[model samples]
Target: MTEEAEEELAEAIQLAQGLEVRGVNLANEGKLNGAMEEFRTALKGLEKFKRRTKLIRARIHYFIGNLHTLQGDLPKGLQEWQKAVRLDASLTDARMNVIKSLSDQGKHAEALRHAQLANSQPSPRVEILVMEGDECKALRNFTCAKLAYARALQANPRSFTAHFQLAVAHRDLMEDVPALHHFERAAEIDPTSSSVVNALAVVRGDTCQWGDPDFSENSPTNLLSVFATRDIHDKASPIHPLLLAYHLDNATLLRVVVDSQAREAARDAAVSVGHAAIQQHTNRPDPHARPRKMFSYKNTFSAFW
Candidate 1:
């Protein structure tokens, strides 16, 4: 813009900086209302340089938002944080507030929209991608969910949540090969997680590949009961009989899994016991649809658990 406009912006930055520093001092001295007033005054100047001074602009909004919350104005505080994120998508803290607000309101789609924006920005973050993946999975959009998790893993392969979610997404999509691979990786990284170990056991039983020593600690009662109590549903989703067999009794496993129809011999018995555990913990129950014919677990050994 013109030199006059540029000079105004520079002066505004100086004014906002002075207010921000003084506000922090007031806040520390137990003068919250005074600090909030200072913060509110700072916003007027920062608003003038919102485009060029993204970091400064966002910081002012964040400060104002914090002061508003300190004054017990949660809704107004959230509004200011929302504005901060809109100006600078890289502001993860501000984005988190917006996401949490949306989620608490049961606005899954809206949360996913902002989460996707956060992931698409520079230095794509793992946490936001996981949130996007979770939101997509909740909506039964497995394809997008897996893609989000995949991007997260691409950004950081050691992310246990990414591996777990990716495995679940692939399992939901009936893509057994990739599902099995990710599940194995997740189990390796977190052997202490019952969900991960239980899911691994189900997959091993399905493919008759029970060689891992890590899968040996789980009790048979815990593992078999999960699979034994459930049967093929009248719905369209596929729940491998092997996964249900672990929860059931001997007779139940014998009856529920075995059938006149031949079962999945395709080393792809991508199990979901592990997935179910995660879902239950996260309060996102699996939406099992399109039932597939499943046969009994032929390799149900006693020590396998």
Candidate 2:
């Protein structure tokens, strides 16, 4: 209550806050244990002045939760974030993490509940709306998903993700016109996005709009470049190999496939060189996950070859 006591409390809170900042720096530098210790020590100190330190304490817990996630302890991270939101109801980041994690774990109903709650708050985030859409989509509620994606686009007209997702939703419903429109918009917003480029091309193909200017100018170059290394980096595109049979001769296609396989193998080896031990421990083969092999069109191109 006295001036001296007030000054001491301020100094203590300042010190705790500094520790939180330091913890964040350490975490960014990949010193997870050191970051965790800093966060815990900061939180412990802040707990002493509970009434004045609630928000800062909540923030510390949020950082700690992030550290837990980086350390591959997702459930523990979720618990920490839950604590953070409880401590400070307006901590939207923590709430968003909780909702996203729940959604990823296929607890769509719970994630939707949290998302709705967050949406009801003032100035809800575009990401929350997108996540709500994703959850609804996962639950097979196409109407709800469309509405959420539309709302996200309404909030941020230039949002590439929202436009792309909305396009996919419309495309799935066999609505080609609107799908083409959104896909084109998405490609315009992020021209380098391979998914948008491929989808845009497919949608145009569906509508038989071969003369579309955007496709003629950029999409084909980007799409075809996926077969070859662009800037010495393998560009990722999931377009089917069969489609390329219509475009190239057998020898060219085989050469492309061979080069692609070799480049992919080299990249894998380079990436694993420093992380072999870590991969050995953590990369146990998933029973349900298969090693995807390159598709061969040997029969389709055999006569030409």
Candidate 3:
């Protein structure tokens, strides 16, 4: 309004921006303490300008809270975030940060409450639902986790993460059949994700459905079974190479079985047997290749002569 007030406002805004830049630079350099100091300095400048701009004041508090959060000072971060929210309830970043900080502190109930509040303001993002599901899972509340994951899947049916997490929730609850199905679905959606493939393989093994006729007929059941068995024996067994070999063998066997359609189903079964033999020879050490045992006698025939 007044020229002098305008000049003071401009100076305060410039100082806040400068402090923010310095804080970001310090944070990038891993100087969390220095960054926090700069953020505090920015907050002080913005507070001085708050009489003219409440929005800028809220932003400064939010950024300060973010800096504290990055430094693992949850209480201080939450306090500042709460202040930011008090100033402007529409500060979604502040609300989300507070929820994350609460969740990190193992306050899942409170975190869920805040998450619900945030969602009430607007439709929550898929990532928020995922976070909520993870927290519920960590708290051993599988039902709530499933619900959250289900909501995420409903929001986007093609979300591989949602399917994978839902599978994990089901597995935790010992719902192996559903877990196996969802795990396989996730692997199908994200074939390049080794974690997904490995998880699906684990669920399949746990369910002992590798021998299931439906999947065993055409799936990589045999190869996955061998891998699972080897892993059970030696936890350090390399799986990726074995899995690759298994896939190749499976492809070759599939072609053989298909081409042998004119023959009986027994012929298809024989193809599987041959594929197993090839896999064993290729992936396992040869038993006959070991040194032969030498036989010894206590008395010789020459002694009798």
Candidate 4:
């Protein structure tokens, strides 16, 4: 090659390198738009240098794909990744990115195909299984979801998300007991998760007691007394203690306080029984020993309104 041609090629290579460096910096800073610009600039700079390094071309396409994916342009992103794969079929990052993007777009069948392709590559990662599980879940293919989740759990038993999602799939299939077990396992893995706690509470029954220490003055009758004062607004139906506390805390009874046919009678009965229950509990000396309070009024009145 002539000295001029060699020097021009070297300068083009340097410009491409500079563009890639700036693009990476932009991407790390969450500047997807700026990063995409830089990547395009790099590609343009390298276009004249057809004999440039294969590694450089692969990296450029991969980065551009990544930026496109981050920008929520999945089609464009996948196209770039496909290009990168063509250049370097062994690029696990590109393959995984394509699969993830496809999955995120709710293209489960396509994603599964891509996932299968990725798994066929050497030393596939556990994340591929997780991705397949997620796609299966989205597609409502519980059997497949369960299989994928099981594989993921086998690969890494400590995967809390996998356990949680498996529980969700089971729950969707009405496998409550198994769902409960997996949910509990997930909670054990991450105790502070409110989602797990709430799910457990709902599936087991909201009234189910969790620990010791009764807060009511009365003896154990049901989970209702654990949180509130139980009393009867009417001779027919008894109100729950927790429901009463909820109404009191909200400064509104279940019965309509105004503008209804049964308003006056309901309010009078609620106040009478609620006041009596409060007095009975207050007269007790051991406040901590008292069961949690409850509303004694039937929820029927609230349900009507």
* Candidates sorted by lDDT, best first: 2, 1, 3, 4
Write one digit per residue (lDDT tens) for candidate 1, span 1-305.
99999999889888888998898888878798888788778877676566777887787787777767667777887798888887777888778667766765678899899888887788878878888887887778999998899999999998878898898787777776677688778756764444564455455554444442222445443433433335444312333434433333334433333331124432223333334334433322133421343221111101100
What C-alpha lDDT values do all the predictions have?
A: 0.64, 0.66, 0.62, 0.60
Cα deviation at 279, candidate 2, in Å, is 49
Residue ranges of candidate 4 with Cα displaced over 4 Å: 1-18, 29-34, 41-56, 69-74, 89-93, 206-305
The better candidate by TM-score, 1 or 4, is: 1
Off by over 4 Å in 3: 1-11, 30-34, 48-55, 69-74, 85-97, 192-194, 206-305
Residue 106 C-alpha lDDT in model 1: 76
What are the clash counts of all predictions, listed in order? 23, 0, 0, 17
Q: How does each model score on TM-score?
A: 0.59, 0.71, 0.59, 0.56
**Most accurate candidate by lDDT:** 2
Candidate 4: C-alpha lDDT = 0.60
The whole-model C-alpha lDDT of candidate 1 against the native structure comes to: 0.64
The alpha-carbon lDDT assigned to residue 2 of candidate 3 equals 88
Better of 1 and 3 by lDDT: 1
Each candidate: RMSD: 13.2, 13.6, 17.8, 13.4
Q: How many Å off is the CA of 49 in candidate 3?
A: 5.4
Best by TM-score: 2
Model 3 clashing residue pairs (backbone): none
Deviation (Å) of 227 in candidate 4: 18
